[model samples]
Target chain A: MRPLELRRIPLFATMTPADLAAVATVVEPVNYQRGTVLFGVGDPCAGISVVLDGIVRLFRRTPERREVTTGIVRAGGLMALCALCGEATHRDSAEALNHVHTVEIPTAALHVLGQRCPHLQEQAMRGLLERLDAVNAAFVIAQEQIPVQLLYLLRSVARLDQAAQRHPGDTMHPLALRLSHAELARLVGTDRATVTRALRLLEEQRLIQRKRGHVTGVVLSTPDRKVPV
Target chain B: MSDGGNRKVWYLRHIDLFASMTDEEVEEIAHLLDDHHIPPGVALLDHRDHDRVYLIKEGAVRLHTGGPEHQVTLALLPPGRMFGLSSTVGDADRTINATTLLPSYICFATWPKMAEVFARYPEVMFQLTRSLAEQVFRTETWLARLGMISPTARLADLLVELSDEFGEPSETGRRIRFRLTQADLARMIGVSRETVSRTMVELGRAGWVARESGRLVVRDRDALKMQANS
Candidate 1:
């Protein structure tokens, strides 16, 4: 796999050239084929994984063996930083959704690098804070609507993917997210029928179009007007 | 109520359960205050064990599942929020574990003291009951989300709730400044990590929201509101 440019990553955007170089030294690159397990639930804490390319899915299996996706990693983002600070092991497993390129940085080295690199430290701390905030909201999400929950998830990934792009604000930039409808339904905690209904609803509204096995030609609707509940 | 050892007067005053007491009454109740410094990362209450109630004098408290993974965070309660309120009514074990976010002071109160207060002061009893009811409502709302809704709908409801609570007025409209991540949403919705990933992609492409700095910027609050509706 071709190496990704570290300077282009939003998580690294604050880094000076020196800071970037320091991070490059510590992040060890590795590649995995599709459907490979990067880590398993209850596995010992290793370190954080930064996706250099491709995609990795983090999920946990229920007692009945149903796999639920906890989140995914494309290039330019970090994963599983919260577990490393404490002794808790991975609560879920990470599997490659496709051929993936990633950099694994042990928690110890990353902490040292944080002290050495201001940008890296800021990034790591910010990520942890973000995770904490997310966990706080997750508390609320565990109680609410599934489709809304799914929408927030998509909005987050889309933003991160856009941020990781070389030109973030350019209109020509489009996020190509590939996943199937069945997978989409399961992630949203619904079945295929609900997914199809929701997708058709979006299609009728011109918010999106479906093609082949993946979603395509996406456009966000305008900001909604506040309606009386 | 009790100045109790020259501690700050506000600590005694702010707690609604203690707020109305006169200095004498506060001091009398202060006799019940058992101060202890809990070290960081220790569990104060175990699941299924309802031994005592803690009033947080200082320090942060987080409620987590009693399971092995402890992946789920139920809530983060700061001072003024009663810890272990459930124990005030019954002898059941705690449903969640209370862990100190920082090394801090906690007042250990027995059920007897709690009963004394409730019986002696009908006002305190009323306020405490109302507070407990609100918490129960919030807990039920959270469980309902995890048990019923899809991830996107759950996320949408969360956004609506956040927007209602914390959203600020901006040229773009009421913007929720708090940031959240996809992984967090996945865990919250109890779905696979990939499900969150794909759903987020689909939503973003459709302009329901925009992600920024790991924050879900609600560019269209109305659209989100519609999606949030069950």
Candidate 2:
């Protein structure tokens, strides 16, 4: 992406035109098709990748070979700055949830840019902290009842839609979730059967909606908030 | 500065975030830090407050979440390690509670001081980023084990990990110097105290680990390693 385009991203928005131009010089644009493994666990971090388009799911494989979905990075979000930091190795694997486009900045160059623009460092740190908070929150949510946990998962997914629709009038938009029941179970740390049962309970309470045995959409009368589970 | 204060500065220099810094830079950063001596069982950071970061100088600390009955130990941080950065990143709520596992000495730096340091030495920011990444990796690994492994394997894995990270060579074998009770082990591995007791019995019968004076000693490293992977 061009320097002007990079300025729109919050991480780079604070940089001066000169600094943005400098950052654009080091920016490498890359694309991946759906289901592409952008990086794997134990792989050395190539650099920091900022999502310009599409979604990337960061997950870990359990000893049983089951995939535990940790969190999602969408357009305008940065992926795993932790990897670029001291360890220099990815802690988990990242795969594209759909056709993905990213602007990759080498760690070395990013450090240079950080020196010139302190806000860049602040923004990246804030992003990392936010992710750490989300992961820890999920750990706590794992202990709650299945239906409560499912509601939390649904709200997490709906957060993306809520972010995409920032207009005040769009608060009532129907948020369509694209995850399967099995996928939802994985995210919520439960089995498919439990997820199915919990979905019915949530539907009974009018907390969520389903179509053809899959959670297709949800309507939030207010701006989406984290439902305590 | 007093000798003790000088020693605190020395400890700060060794932290990964300040390791690359020059003595002058370290001294400059050290001026912004305040030393604290936290008693065992006292919380250094509450889950509700997330404004300061601390670097362990003398003992260990446990990072946990939830109330007393449902607490889960997310990590056991040793000397030279930093905690509370997640709070300093933004106005985010502290995700974990940090309690001193033993009488500990730590250096506290508020978010503003930390930000000033980062601005002066961007490399320190890079180092902090790396440290946080390592923590994320470790937490992810623990979560994966909790979800996929049996309770026996989970306890075995935690023992081995703690031993590797904090153990000292003893005449008999490797002994974990820190005081870890069955309840602590259960919290660390996300199991019940009863489960930890039973697993300890199993491990003890196998001659893999033994407890002495409230500390765990690993007798057969290979056996414990085998059980952890099994």
Candidate 3:
């Protein structure tokens, strides 16, 4: 694997050039094959993982063993940073959706570096704060109706694939996660038929479109989808 | 802060975000804060404004989004909790709206003031990061319960948890400290007010709970426990 670039991760974005050089030596780049299970729920969280390439999905398994996705991370996304909150274990399992590459920095090392590096912990906290905001929104959105839930999940998928899309703006975000209705249903925490009907409704409203040349590809008609959700 | 300057230092000492700071350093940050009281229902933080930091001195704040008919309640924060993470997060955008759930005394300061405190006492920044991380877990725990549980079970479990934290012994049962409306209960459990009202009626019929002078009384602890676990 290539050496990790400390500056690429938002948690280390504020480190000065000298400080960044010092920090780069601490992060270890790791690559996982497609469909690799990165971490399992309740496993001791070793440190934060900063994605450098490809996508990772964080999910939970129900009592009946159904996979329900909580969030997604692509290149430049950070995972397990919440361990800074002193959690003992990973709250949700994470799996690589493709051939994912990430840089792992031990929690203790980051703290030690924060003590030496100016504006490091502060910048990291800002990133975590934004994540807290996203999770807080998810808490509320989980209770909403099916259409609202689908739209919200679509928006999240749109974000993961933002860099790949040529047309980027407020409206019509093309999705990259070519997941089937069953997978999308899992992401939205619903049944396949229900998700299928909801997608059709969204298509009827022109809020999304089935992507060309892919059976399961769905694109957000408008990324800034304002609703009661 | 009607009690004046010394009192400001007193409140900052209690906030978890500043728990690692020395009393002298707490006093220094206190002097820079503008303390004010917010009436219930008054919006405290606008999502667009990210340069100010708020530390709750007294009462509660509701972090939420959406409008009247479809509003979603995020978190009901208690005293000693800090908001507006500019000192820790830098120039980050806030996603949720915060409003006073009760008449609240809040101490706020510009990001520059907070930045100086963070720079001088890096421990305070560490504390805030840990605190926000805890908030993330807390919210996720709530989301999991709200998404997966039955309405009856959610209410029973909520009442039990709230009672554990805020209940006091009464003649017939334990009385919850706060006066929570059906609407409030509904919001917390991610159910409808009608559902809460209907469930309350059922609980009342089953001798599980009662309303005593507008406060909720858990009349049968064992029964509520059984229902909660079921």
Candidate 4:
């Protein structure tokens, strides 16, 4: 909406005032409510969007048409940057986790402006590199055995919530998140029955305790183990 | 092209980051690349922006995590692909080890040197971005395939991907550049070695996969892809 607002985004933070203003002029503010699909796989990458508020989920469908959550982004995060900058089409679909606000910079304008601004193009390259590295880690967590898999996934989500820092010195982390078995299955790419089985196993080992059907907390048996990422 | 200098130019051109550059520009930049040969099974130390970016010029490298007792192969780096940026993954604060899968030739340049070239030929940023983005999509696709319901399906998915990424046309079918041991296949798919041996035997009987000059050849890629989805 405003050039100052655009400058607040780190991607534009290093740009000269002239370059920032040129980019700010192209950003179109868009908003969505919870449960709305923002974009689907194969959609032309319209442009890079910077999240102004709320959370968004990025996922890809399995061959069986099951949704497997890949990454989560909150306010102050950038979306579609890698696809818009690197690829022609969006590789994954995005959905609003809640009421969300995002501003998208039109591709044509960004391209025209990028030719004159090295900073914009450099930031996009750096962002793509970071995204690639982050997804690489997620793939590692996904391959861990089921019970350990769920624990890692929770910790991952908590990292987004900044909840992990709440117990910085403690072994146990209270997730305080309520998710249905089906949702849990989607996150881990397993069936609800398998999720139930894994949850039971985690409970028996005293690694996790559920409260009122919500995952209350988790305990890593060896918190100081050489983290294999 | 037989000379090291000319061969290096050819290899550098194959990399997407340098694909769109003029021959003269490529020749100029090729001189900036430092080359080295590594024996199979040797590990690469972590490389950062200052240390330099390395690309596989010949042979393959394996990226894996976990201790030696339980190593899981995450990816097999094909020629023209870069290495080292994957040194860290998220907040794990740990390093992913890369070991040479075969005797290899690697070419590298520090970020500062690469940036100088990028400044000189602005178009390279686009190519580099596309290269990085495609890598992200491939990694994501590999992640999804690992979630398939059956070990057979998982193995099929892996085979189809291997042929797509690192295989070449052969008399029998698509011959994978790397000779993967059944043990290597097992470690990659996170299944037991015996399971990989049995699955390979089955695929061989089905006429979908075969061995050629010690490399894997995918004879029926369409059928293999179908099985991967099934």
Number of the top-ranking candidate, with DockQ as the measure: 4
lDDT of all predictions: 0.58, 0.75, 0.73, 0.75
Provide the TM-score of chain A alone for each candidate, in the order shown. Answer: 0.72, 0.85, 0.82, 0.78
Model 4, residue pairs in steric clash: none
lDDT of 2 by residue, B104-127 (tens): 888888888878888788988877
Fnat of candidate 4 is 0.49
Please give, for residues A69-119, the per-residue lDDT of candidate 3 as tens digits: 666776776688556766668887889877899988788787787788648
Query: In model 3, what is the error at residue A43, expressed in angstroms?
Result: 1.5
Model 4 has an lDDT value of: 0.75
- DockQ numbers for every candidate? 0.04, 0.43, 0.39, 0.53
Candidate 3: tens digits of C-alpha lDDT, residues B1-230: 35787787887777888777788878778887899988888887755566887878887777766667766667777787787662111012224567886788898888898788788877778887777767776676566656544688778877887677557899998987667789878887889899999999999999989999989999888888778666
In candidate 1, what are the lDDT values of residues B1-230, reduced to their tens digit?
Answer: 34545464456566766776787776666676687778667788753556578877766666665354334556555555566644211111214567876576778887678667655654455444334433433443454455444567767766666566545666544555544456545655567668878877776787866665545666677887677564
lDDT of 4 by residue, A67-122 (tens): 87776666656677554544567878888877889988776776676678877778
lDDT per residue for candidate 1 within A118-206, as digits (tens), equals 45544544443344334334444433454445444444445445443344331322346665777777665567877777666555655
Clashes of 3: 1
Please state every model's RMSD to the true fold in angstroms.
20.1, 3.6, 4.1, 3.5
The candidate scoring highest on TM-score is 2
**What does the TM-score come to for chain B in model 2?**
0.89
Instruction: Provide the TM-score for each candidate, comma-separated.
Output: 0.47, 0.88, 0.85, 0.86
Error of 3 at A103 (Å): 2.4
What stretches of model 1 exceed 4 Å from their correct place?
A: A1-5, A10-23, A62-65, A132-150, A163-175, A225-229, B1-74, B78-230
> Once superposed on the true structure, which residue ranges of model 3 sit more than 4 Å away at CA?
A1-4, A61-68, A164-171, A211-229, B1-3, B39-41, B46-50, B85-95, B164-176, B203-209, B217-230
